[model samples]
Target chain A: MVDSGRAPRRGRPPVSDEQRGRQRLDISRHAVRLFAEQGVAATSGEQIARAAGVSERTLWRCFPTKESCVEPLLTKMLDAFRTVLHAWPPGVGLIEHLRTAYQPVLDSSSGEDVEAVLAVVRMTHDEPALRAAYLVLRERAEETFTEVLAERMGMPPATFEVRVQAATMNAVLKVAADEFARETVGRGITPEVLKDHREQLAHALGLVTRRLSGTDVG
Target chain B: MVDSGRAPRRGRPPVSDEQRGRQRLDISRHAVRLFAEQGVAATSGEQIARAAGVSERTLWRCFPTKESCVEPLLTKMLDAFRTVLHAWPPGVGLIEHLRTAYQPVLDSSSGEDVEAVLAVVRMTHDEPALRAAYLVLRERAEETFTEVLAERMGMPPATFEVRVQAATMNAVLKVAADEFARETVGRGITPEVLKDHREQLAHALGLVTRRLSGTDVG
Candidate 1:
């Protein structure tokens, strides 16, 4: 809604925050594709810039390091997560909220965006630098989970119990993300079968965290 | 004991496993310090090689990426955990084994080594590149935990229950490491009291994973 095609009346033909974010995401998407096609070490900032149709200096402006070219794409994977957490209703349970949010997030996301995200995450397993970028994002996501869980559980984020919950919850989500990524990383699963994997994730989360309820039979 | 000093008269210089492990640890220790002192972005392979007193080519031989230069030092932090797991006798609980293993691990680790590890981990909070490396190490640690938990729980490593245990257990450890690293990263903690932090880790592990017992009041 914020995109204005016209040249702005403001000084320096200003770039909006939304525009800047999109630009960076575009550049990162290109970088990830290049890194995946060849290899991260073999791919240079100049090549990424050329593929993205931007100046190398502009690429550096958006990303300080070459290894960080995947950060924006990694952040994309977590966009649904953060949004879901932020909008989580106070009365609803965590599992219920996750199940509710899953399909909508998938529906809203373009196939290409999800494809790029999974591609980048898959590369993290093989590429140390990209993996590092991916992990940094994971750590940030855990921090967000801690805050959200703390608020929901009526405890400080730093409380020992809360942190464990946050960590374990994130771990379950990670396992799901891993499964989804694995499907794409290999021969690529069809959307219909992929939906079954989503259900698998929901089931896994319930099983893993059911100990919290004391309801699951060992 | 296997660190023999005798030079090999064969095709390549014979380095004992212990000796090679130590050599890699030494190089990685130096690299982490360099990363800590200067940002990872600013640090160069040549600078790290000079600091470690190795040729640039030798540094490349030891580590494929500049980001991976810290891997050996990280592996050192987990060495105690792995060794303790390997020696975990049957009929012993997981918590009990950890408590028994904690002190000896700390005692065997050199002050300099621990300092380097904490330094890098702390940097992870602020440095994206280093954070990635730390996360990569954390992932491998999870795999190892999965194997150990599989044996202890009498299940396959890939079992859902086994993985949840592995992930949760690693999360607890990460909290302890985070606390310990926090102390070292800032004002540094006393070694005697630092010993207490190890116990805190043991206690936290018990509390976090106790739910696995099917007995939580919550």
Candidate 2:
């Protein structure tokens, strides 16, 4: 809050929305790359600051901790999912909407950003601190899914039926994302592999939905 | 890491397995009370150490963080659920097993433990740091449920179907507990209300299973 008042504006006056998003994404990718190369414990905030090409002060201003540097990246992923989720029309089934939008959601992010996200996620499989950050991001995503599920099913988000459905959907999506990351993120993703996710998600959702609720909205 | 050598444990030779559990529960109740009464931020580990009648060193030994002081109380509630989930035989449906086990689960914990757990969980609805801890507990519980769901359904524990069902059941259980806590813990629990939880849980599970997986085992 302090030095932003007088640091002498650099390159486009605090940046446009697009420019800010680019900066955050760029910083996250650099932070995640360093995290992947070196474990979370060994990685320092100063290292992250240098890797991200921001002043140490700016880095701290953006992220309270080195672990939190991954959060904006996770938020980018969450935002993509929410963008797809919130646009659902009542007539379309959840899985159907998800299947159609799934490719676009991942495609929306640049390759560097996607690689950074997967690196952070892969780290979460082993890192406790990062897992905490990852799960909190997921909790935020779950809230979005919960609200949408409530609306779609005509129930309060607090009600057991809606909540279970939402939580289950969130689980399904996480599994889908994890699987996709495992298969393609490091090896390189193709348009074909991306489309394959549509089928995988649909089948998983369809099986789970039939087992969970007999009614097929689609 | 700590010198228990100097402070001489006051009660009954450092407690038996059963007594150790009681001591932990007692400490947690005091911790939760101070957390609720004075606020988690304002409440000091020294204060908890004083109230629970343990050395400052012992408090640090027991709980790595002040917030984690709630873990034992949460574990008591989780243990009850796992005891119910684990004992499911091959023939019984999930809901039937849950209904039979629900009453015994709550009856197992002391009133103080139950209230402490409820206080922590209610605070989770508003507190970010505590909510992360609370969700982590649920994640642990979900792992337990996943194994049970896999066994009951004759699937691998890691399979998508089993994972989704387990996560959904976990969500349903959280909702039931939250609803139960809001209704009874503050006002005081009654036999009628406590017994009614079986009905409440049964109803939630029945609706969810029917919605999720239509084939009833019972």
Candidate 3:
């Protein structure tokens, strides 16, 4: 068995990565619904666990704090942005590239997922815990932004200017997203409203990064 | 007594605003010191209370979370910036105004106060709890920034563009401050180093706000 290509598993087999991801998403969906229906302060871990059909122990293992239950959803949004940025072609304008590539992804994303994400974002306005979770995830994405921006600008990722640009870019995007989500939460997020948000984000990002060499073609 | 200049006093005499401010500052100093000596995770509320010569109840009343002990200092910094912005004259460049008016405030501030503030800012890098406190304070200050920028730009404060600029400005300042604090924490803060920080901040702010009519004269 030691010489075989596949090594013998120890004890019980661990949960597969896809299963873990699905579980997290399920819990995040339940947590977001609870948070939206009842305020984050009124929602508890047990309630969330019950709603998600998971035990308290499993919930705690998956997320350390009740506030952090939204991480998987937030991370998914950030990951999409990062993926789009990584695919951004050199010599193409950032806004144009995002409109071309990122817009389709947003259009294709399930309405339920988008609504959950918007609800979480909308809740961040009043809930400090949720806001912190959101900010921390956004902060983590800044490094990825810095690297991509640095490559495009021919500067080190750690350079003050490059880092500042990356941070400003993220801040503009975040503020725009927050504003859109806040305004669109009460009324349903129509395709028109979503398009408006995308335009607003692109416009803000373009204005902030206009001075950078590889960012603005306009 | 109601007709008289002095109204009838209720129950026990309340603590004076000055006294409350002093008490908060003292507790904050102690908390910052302990957090610096030992990591934030290792420091307890009781230890902070003891170090500050206050009861745990009082400490809790002053700061709900142990991480929020730094709010007093952070608010002081933001208040200074807000004051400077309010005093800023139209037609004057932002960076030049800061250099002329703000530099003196920094110069006159006690070294100990500066060190404590820097220590708190530096700690925000690795400590998620502390980082949350710091970010929340910074987020609050965005309103002041928005108001100032809006007045100068002749736009409504709540306008999306104005708000985005305000958020971006705060993000740039925060990133710069964190960087400066991280770099200067080990070596004692020097006047030269302080000036360098001011310049870096002004420069970064200028770069981000260059396109705005009221912010950049250059």
Candidate 4:
């Protein structure tokens, strides 16, 4: 039987997943700026579309609601961490991998992305929908951590130890990143400071992993 | 100079703090019942007063808004873990402390309080105000963890290691508790099974502490 799920051949080829994702993120960036400038309720779909240089129909096609506009940007921030973890080399200590591979993203010229992240954090403080979105992202990150952890330790993801370790690690990273974001906004702390935070996070994760696995990975 | 903040009394008041707290809790219990039955927006300060058998003015004096009526119940549930941690003995391991102290408060002979706690959880899913209040409680709980961890490790609360470790532990406890709540609602998991999640939590915390301190408590 033909797989109906597959994209149908048409005059214009379907947008690649990567292109669709970029368009979604483009809309999110515009939506965030609008949401930040005006309140979420005051912002209109047309305004976001205008800002993103896309048609209103295109914006709606990408996001069901204006509140959901934050998802792509938020998801990208989380995916950055997940990408690092996925690329982590086996037998290399967690701390070393984080310090060496993770620091460049924050320090690169793409500092505007860091500012976008801060806007989401500020929005979460007052916007319930955005806060819920942020929490959902966090839950997904925890699952990713659980999978990576289970693979590293040769255990099933459902194992109690793996779940607990994943939860602990998730909590640490979240709290640390939150504090870092706050500092970045309130005290003008640079992303470089986050390097030290990453090291501490790695140490915290290492401790939990060692205890759960009954072997030290550090 | 007389200290303005100091208590001005020849002797202590007739009602103890515990008695006052119980009285407030009673009012909160009735208010939550009305809120759950009639909905928060439909319920009013005057109606809550009548249900709790108190004056409307008294209800206002206690809580600023109708939504906050659930705070007392929500705070009590969140405080349960911290109260246990505060009473933890030095010789006991973290896991043992949790298992021994955590009883199924819902299964106790007092079934009314169980209903109140469940109502708060159910409301949290829909009520934005309640969700914000719930998050504030979580933040307080994390602070409590930080204090306990700092004391245990003989480090100042401002210490980087202490903060990171506390964050990880807080995350683990939150995820485990969240899972327990979800499971209890969806799968009819008993309190006994929920309590079993604590062992994994303790193991997670144990690993975090060992990694940070370079020594095992158990």
Candidate 5:
């Protein structure tokens, strides 16, 4: 029963999914750095590939378009937010829970990561292509928020109230990000700046969700 | 010394901006009809032009792309919303003002116009290109809302609170429109349905903007 070629393992193991993700993240970091240094219009996939030490083919395989190179970082930020939101303690106000849980993540992120994320956010304010990518990612993330909020409130995901709640929460977060980006124009993200960012977010979230409770949103 | 072709002396009066807008709106209605009859993918620009009783060149001039043919209708909807919001009476609660001032517009809209608008909104739920166009129009409209809300709240347009308020307001309206579209599936918009739509919008707006006041958002 010689099935070596048909069903047996190859000599070299395939790259793990985690390894591929890491490679994509690394490429995204390089692409973002180039975009920040130059501009999105002037940056090219070939330049990003060269900077990331990957072939152009590999870079294309990782991203469908040049503008999408920022998706990895944007998705990472959203994933962190979703993680914090999903782990929110029951019976505690969402604003208070977010203040306690989400603030530390912002405080503890590597300065370089924060800078890159902020730079991408700020660039989105002016770059239409980058703004499109950021918005697409945000819209996709909002679907998950709809599901989570619906479950928390014992309502269907398609209910208008649940849908709007999710949309409003994301809208508040997006505006807060834009504000943070604006604040970082000349000044970098310092402890004081980050704290201000956190408080601004909390204040906005409090205003938005003050009426969203399990029993009485409508 | 007449400049002849370079100067005045046009035989026929130029198409007024209002006439051009009417032409675009007419072309858009035809395009939407074709899209509703056939899927967006199956509908062609030439087909839309034929249905619209115009040259393909005219249709192309009217819309940058086939997907954007829906923009005129979406923009009209946003413009109407802005008109209502701008005319909202002061010293009255927003929800109450919207109910008194905005609900009549919805109730009085011609049935055909409401049907076409609902069809386009419902189609956006399935078509990504149309959704992009819809989102682009909404984002542009939000900028004006930002200005209006900031002025009403006595804050800078770029302030985080005002920006988020504008965004949340648009998000609520968008979700309410989506709900209205969903309700129209297999049935037409009725008085009761439209009333429910108005209440849902007011409720969602109340939830998002309960704390947005002239002096105390922060």
Candidate 6:
């Protein structure tokens, strides 16, 4: 007999990895809606599962705890940024690369995705567990920026100037994104507003990188 | 009957405000020691009060919750930065002001104060509540930097450039401080090393500020 915990044997079709990831994200989206509507404390695993039209057992299997349900959504946002950086071409300046790659993603992402991001932001204000998760993701994002920056600068990520520039650049992006999220929550987000925010961030980070590198690429 | 909640009459000897603040800090120091020696979850309010040599009532009066015990120490460190910013001269640039103000504080702070700072840093790694406290302190620090940058640029603090500069500068200082704290814990903190770290942070922030401001300060 095949173990229930393990994947189905060769006789039956197995669940695709992409399908599983999507399902997890679907659950997270529903969980966030429930959290935003009611308080986190008032929401439960069963409620989240029902909202997503899944069994409680499946919800538990997907997320060990309710607090972790937000991870998939948060990770999506970070992953989008990483994808932008990864596709950045050589010899292209930082601002130009960010604008070209990042703009496309912002344009393609739907209104619901933006709402999910806002939910995560609002949750971070009161939920300590969620806040920790968000901060850890940010720390990892900074490290990712450091690696990309080092590659661009022809220096080790551990070098002082590279690390400093990475930190400053990371800070500028974060502050700009946070400000955008805050504004989005207060006044519904629009394409023009997001474009403006991205431009400002790219410009600010570009300025910092130029100064730290002591070069005039612009 | 007199109200027990109210302060003593004017004729009676009054507890000096400085003495009261010190008392709160003393409680926080002990609370941190208890948290470090034993895990936060394992430690209780009664134990913290006992460790602090204060009655439970007094502990409750000072702090609304057990997690808040770290606030006093965290506030002290943040206040130190604010104090330096407040005293900054008009003609001085960011690096020069930081170097001058930071060196004296480092030289004057007692070893115990340094230990307390380290405790807060260590707590931030695992404790969600403490991490929130630390982040809030960082937010305040960013605002303080914004004000300073605005003053230096002869602009209002509400300007976008000032806010972005403040955010970048705050991020640099935070990364540098976290690095220093981790190194201090792993090896040991010495006067020379502390001075070097301060200078590096000042230089990093100065470069970023100059770039953002389009100034030729360096």
Worst 10 residues of 3 chain A by lDDT: A209-218
lDDT for each residue of candidate 4 in A1-218, tens digit (9 for 90 to 100): 98885866668777799999888988888899889888787899999999999899988888866777988877767777788888888777676677677753453326676687777887787876566556655766778989988888788997767777777777767766766666677655455667666776666666555643223442
Q: Per-residue lDDT tens digits of candidate 3, residues B1-218? A: 35773777768888899999988988888899999999999999999999999889989999878988998877887777788888989888878878777752364356687778888887788898888778888888999999988988778999998998899989898887777787786788767877887888888887777555444532
Give the best candidate by DockQ: 3
Among all windows of 10 consecutive residues in model 2 chain A, the one with the lowest summed lDDT is A209-218
Interface RMSD after interface superposition, model 2: 2.6
Candidate 2 lDDT: 0.74
Q: CAPRI band of model 2? A: acceptable
Q: What TM-score quantifies how close candidate 3 is to the native fold? A: 0.90
Candidate 1 share of real interface contacts: 0.39
lDDT of 1 by residue, B110-212 (tens): 8777777778878877876666677778888889988977877777888766776677777777777877777655565576557777677777767656433
Off by over 4 Å in 6: A1-23, A41-46, A49-68, A104-108, A122-133, A185-188, A211-218, B1-23, B53-68, B104-108, B126-133, B186-188, B211-218
User: Candidate 3: which stretches are off by over 4 Å?
Assistant: A1-16, A104-108, A213-218, B1-13, B104-108, B213-218
The residue pairs in collision within model 1 are A132-B132
- Prediction 3 global C-alpha lDDT: 0.82
lDDT score, candidate 1: 0.74
For model 1, the DockQ equals 0.42
Question: What is the lDDT, from 0 to 100, of the residue B169 in candidate 6?
Answer: 76
- Looking at model 4, the pairs that clash are none
lDDT of 6 by residue, A53-170 (tens): 9999999998766877887777777777777877777656667877767863364366687677777887777876566556655766778878977877788998777788877877
Identify the candidate with maximal lDDT: 3
Worst 10 residues of 6 chain B by lDDT: B209-218
Q: Score the docking of each candidate (DockQ).
A: 0.42, 0.32, 0.65, 0.34, 0.57, 0.40
Lowest lDDT 10-residue stretch of candidate 5 chain A: A209-218
lDDT of 6 at B63: 83
Winner on TM-score (2 vs 3): 3
Ranking of all candidate structures by their DockQ, best first: 3, 5, 1, 6, 4, 2
